[model samples]
Target: MMRSIDYGNLMHRAMRGLIIEVLRQVEEGGLPGEHHFFITFDTRHPDAALADWLKQRYPEEMTVVMQHWFDNLHVDDEGFAVTLNFGDQPEPLYIPFDAIRTFVDPSVEFGLRFEAPADDDEDEEEDDDGGDDDPAPSSDRQDAEIVRLDRWRK
Candidate 1:
């Protein structure tokens, strides 16, 4: 029998809603205690809005810390916007829900990872290229440890 529901998608949506709710609370009142967020997103996603320089720097993905430095945070159903400092220069970023790869709050050891949608136009031949493939970690992720939730899921 065909599965009656898309449980994975539903779970993802619920988790995304949790992030929104947390942001809403933070907006009303500052983070209580040591709460903070580490949000990683796909820079190449069409809905991601970032500075040209930032795009050039983090070509594939980028992560941002929403702690003591961010400002003008606005979250809507579709996405969120906030300004963060990059080398003493404040840069505004807009990231859609679809672009988010992960969200974590290390203070509480809470985290979630969302799978990015596959690109339909990708060439199959490009997958066979054998080259030096040392994965470069995102700069913001260096010190931000996250608790992954994959094992908890069936």
Candidate 2:
């Protein structure tokens, strides 16, 4: 017998498209009209490359601020890359199109979550605030770390 399609995965896939589009908007126009994005993804994912020092320090989740402080923003068919200063250190990151897991904009209460590709056998670390509602620091950084999540959508 024929099997039914999984709508859950289908929806997740659709959200993936929307997430990329939103990101492209920022990539193109530089976060127009008070629209900033909170994007979280796997730091150790194959296509992502952080300075060895940052990987040692964070080991897992990193969240980036796409407002006020980001540079070298470029996007292509493969994915996007950008430069942001973390603390006093500058880092470059390459993110694949399929690696983005969550996108949120607190300014408008808009959000999207998806099943991004996973890293292999890496122990996930919780955010420093113990999963509480602590605001991420806003600095004059040109780049921010991509935020990491404590839990998976699956």
lDDT of 2 at 90: 66
Give a tens-digit lDDT track for model 2, residues 1-154: 7499656566655666666687678787778778777776656557777788767765555666677788888887667888887886667887765555567776666766544323222355446522222232222111112233324322
TM-score of decoy 1: 0.74
Number of clashes in model 2?
8
Model 2 Cα shift for residue 148 (angstroms) = 15
Candidate 1 residue pairs in backbone clash: none
Judge candidate 1 at residue 97 and give its lDDT. 75
lDDT by residue for model 1 (43-120), tens: 776778999988887776777888888888888988898989988999999988777767888777689766423322
Each candidate: RMSD: 9.2, 10.0
Candidate no. 2 TM-score: 0.69
Per-candidate local distance difference test: 0.69, 0.60
The stretch of ten residues in a row with the least summed lDDT in candidate 1 is: 124-133
